[model samples]
Target: MSSQNADVVLVHGAWADGSGWAKVIAPLAAEGFSVTAAPLPLTSFADDVAALERALERKTGPVVLVGHAYAGAVIAAVRSEKVKALVYVAALAPDEGETVADVFYRGEPHPQAPKLEPDSHGLIYLPPDAFPTAFAQNAKADALAVLAASQRPISPASITVPVGRPLWKDRPAWYLIAEEDRMIRVDNQRYMATRMKAEQRSIPADHMPMVTSPAAIVDIIRDAAAAI
Candidate 1:
């Protein structure tokens, strides 16, 4: 499928919403690719997958599914054949029977990584400071402020569940490693990308490259879409 004929579905990770992909959407749309930033409720693994499916149902052609941060597992859980490619951006990719948390915590946490815990409502939110310190360390003051203000708390149930065989195993997969990320370490990203045998690209970006390095994010997504 050509780029213009493909649909690009972008899924955000924990503590973020569809708006986090603001920088990427316009550029891809301008390239004649129909792009949709699928909103994940961050409620549960199943719920996020269902939400992604609903978004996919609204698309008419082949899809290049992209996931950022924690949404990696969410995108992988989807079984849609329309998803012709998978692009993981500083994202996780747990193998069959492995939980999102299992891969997320595979190695030592970054020194600046936030100490996350469930609040009284059983949801985990990134600390305000974590946005500038770890989540998107390369983001500017204004962007960081907006990110912290618009943050969404993710439910523990979302990461604690075991994922089935990932779609990356069956599709052409690409991984963009955030070399400067403090949330998910570079070693872990390399390990996951290698394990999945994905075409890997590395850049000096923090966890949220879609915000800090939108052009790089757009380049990879464009490549993924073009490959389809």
Candidate 2:
């Protein structure tokens, strides 16, 4: 299938920006697939969704919208007609009337998962140590440093708002479950994948599989695009 007219739009999770999709962009582009990462303000649920909608507007033709962590919620809220498929990489998927917190705190917390309390500014940041242990346990030291330094603070309001019907319900979907993830419980990923009835792949990886297991991410996205 010719991917010339199809674009893959990547959305990052909390504590990260478009840079989170940096490793996957070149390879997808090299494969003749146009790829770009969306920049989200992460100020609130509405703000993030608006940012994603703006990014979707920039891309022409069909789009394979992929979200990681909190961005899963962003992609799900979008009603864009250009999107051909939805891809979740260890991402959160909230249903209608449900908040991100409702699904996130569903199952037993991972042992390494840290308790989060928002700062005085009402934004939440993953602690410096949380990145190495809970976020990307197996990532290289240098990569960890960069991830830690570039962490973005997610507004608490963003996670509390209720979501509408997820985009996954209306479009074909694929999911990648990080088996070794400490941020979102592995069981939760399985439950979500099953709930969405997504084409799912479970791999032994940390939370930030795009950094630790980029190939896996690329292949799943490739498959999702080709199928689309």
Candidate 3:
């Protein structure tokens, strides 16, 4: 399908919601791509996949599914035929039988990366300071404020589960590596991208490039959409 004819779905990772993709949405839409940010419940892996599938069901044409950070695994779990391509932005791509944690912790984390732990309710939250310090270290103070304020706690069940065969194995995939990412180390991003055999684009942005480097993210997604 032509770029304009295909649909684009943006999925946010843990500690984030659809609004995290605000900068990305407009430019893609302006390029004539019908774009929607799919919201994950952050409750469980299965719930996130089901939620993404529901979003796919509502789309009218081929889709370029884009995922950031933790949502990478969520997007890969969907078995949708409408997903014509996969675009991972500093995202994970765990192989069959591997858990998200396996890949996320494959390499050393940036020193400033937060120490995450589940709260009494069993939900893992990104420490507020982590937003400015690691998650989006390159983002401005205003952007950091929005991210911290809108952050959603992710359930432990979301990352601990083993994933089946990933959709990236069957579909064309592109990876955008966040070189300065503190949350997911740059080497981990390279490793995952290489393992998935994805076309890689390196950006000198932090973990949250959709906020700090939207133009680069938009360009890569546009490339993926056009290729499809």
Candidate 4:
């Protein structure tokens, strides 16, 4: 498919900003496709969806909305006709009436996730110790340190708000399972992929595949874009 036919929008997960997609953006853009790395507020589900919707409105042609981790929940909430397909990258593909927290705690607890505490505003922030193992397990120490220092505080409300609609149920979906993920277990990802009826690919990477396996992730998005 021609580059003009598809616009790839990358949505970041919680505890992260748009820079989370920095490693993968160039390669996808190098393929001659228009791309946008959406910087989500990570505040509330509704706010994040609204932010994504605003970004979607900027695209001139059909879009492939790619969500990573918590942003998967965000993308699922924003069901835009302009979005031709949905791609989940080690993302939380929650079902209707489900929330990200529900999916995470339903399964066994992740050892790496630090004990999260809500602030006066009810926003949850990942403690520094959890960053290395939970988020950037494959990244260099220096890079991981930078990420940990800059981690965004997630609004607690996003975890409890049930998804109104799941885009994967209607839109063609693609899922990339990070086999070595420590935060979201591989089994959970597999279950979600199956439930979404998504075309699946597995990579032996950590939670952040876009950082460690950008080419593979980009290829999946490309295939999904072509199929759509």
Candidate 5:
């Protein structure tokens, strides 16, 4: 598929909305590629997948779906045949029967993720103190504060639910590894990338590479777009 015929849909992770892709959107748009940042409901796997499929249905041509953190699971659940490629940005790339929580707490202890306690309504919100170090370690002070303030609580049930099908199994994939990511370890990222047989690129950044290194992230996305 030609770059002109490809739509790049960016998917944001937990505790964040689609606005998190603000830095990368204009650059991709400038490259003459139509881009849409899918605003995930973060309530459940089904809702998130439905929202992404709705976005995919709007696209007129081939798609390059980029998922960051928890959004990877959402993208995997989408059945849209329009998706021609997948880009994982420090994201959770789960397998056929894997869940986000299962992938995260699979082996070793995650020292970075605090023990989150959900509210009576089953919403899991990160504490204020964990934001600067875990979510946006590479971001500037002002940006980190904004991210923390804008953080939305995710549904606890979304974590353990398994994905029915993973697009990475069929679609070409590229993994952008953030070496300094505290939220998701570098080892786990490598494991997922290897599992997906993705083309890997390492960048010295934190969890939110689109914020800290938007240019680099755009370049990777451009390469993925070119591949399509």
Candidate 6:
């Protein structure tokens, strides 16, 4: 049941890349898990999912897929049998016929939530200032700066595209609810977790807990691996 024998793939949400999981990676590796931070283009839902598929191709055997934020939707899109379990770290798990946006824009927006829209290039990027404030208030100053500078711009289609029956419906899953998340409302996270019937744990951290609370994420991933 040790994760050391399993392939643990980490998927990051929008406006960020594999580096978002930087804080969690070494720790997971230290514990003997074969970990990978999947790279997503964030161009569109299909594109993101395809990128994840490529990452999966690099691994072998049963895999525990861990997704955060936008990567949640990406993880559910995979049809690979190697994926043994899913870990939703404040992720959005849309059901059949539901778009990521449908779950995202559901409840009243957090008062301080940044207004989002696609730019002239048809991609959406989180504002620089929103990094330290709404996204990861608990992150260190240098970490926040790196995040703001290197963030990716996601296509608006990434949200509007509807999904089919997610793999989570047929696979074992875990949900980590970020209670203080400002990007994706906590209520929305609750609704998704409830509907998916996932094993849930509420953590007192912002959306990017991989940086502020890496141990918690590692613990949850380890637990999920144990069950698998």
Ten-residue stretch with the least lDDT total in model 3: 1-10
TM-score of each: 0.98, 0.98, 0.98, 0.95, 0.95, 0.97
Estimate, for each residue in 67-163, the C-alpha lDDT of model 1 and write its tens digit: 9989999899998889999999999999999999999999899999999999999889998889889998889999998899999999999999999
Which candidate, 3 or 6, has the higher TM-score? 3
Candidate 3 global lDDT: 0.92
Which regions of candidate 2 fall more than 4 Å away from where they truly are? Answer: 1-5
* Residue range 1-228, candidate 6, lDDT tens digits: 334757899998888888889889998888888889988888888888898999999888689999999889889999888999999999999999999998888889998889998889888889888988899988989989888887988898788999988999999999999999999989999999999999999999998999888888998999998887
List the global CA lDDT of all models: 0.92, 0.91, 0.92, 0.86, 0.86, 0.89
Error of 2 at 195 (Å): 0.4
Q: After superposition, which runs of candidate 5 have C-alpha atoms over 4 Å from their true positions?
A: 1-3
Q: Residue 38 of model 4: what lDDT?
A: 90
RMSD of every candidate to native, in Å, equals 1.4, 1.4, 1.4, 1.7, 1.8, 1.6
Residue lDDT tens for model 4, 152-205: 988887788888778888899999999988888899999999999999999999
Best by lDDT: 1
- Quote the lDDT for 3 in model 6: 47
Cα misplacement distance, residue 10 of candidate 4 (Å): 0.4
Candidate 2: worst 10 consecutive residues by lDDT? 1-10
User: How many steric overlaps does candidate 4 have?
Assistant: 0
Stretches of candidate 1 exceeding 4 Å from the true structure: 1-3
Candidate 2 residue pairs in backbone clash: none
Residue 61 in model 2: shift from native, Å?
1.1
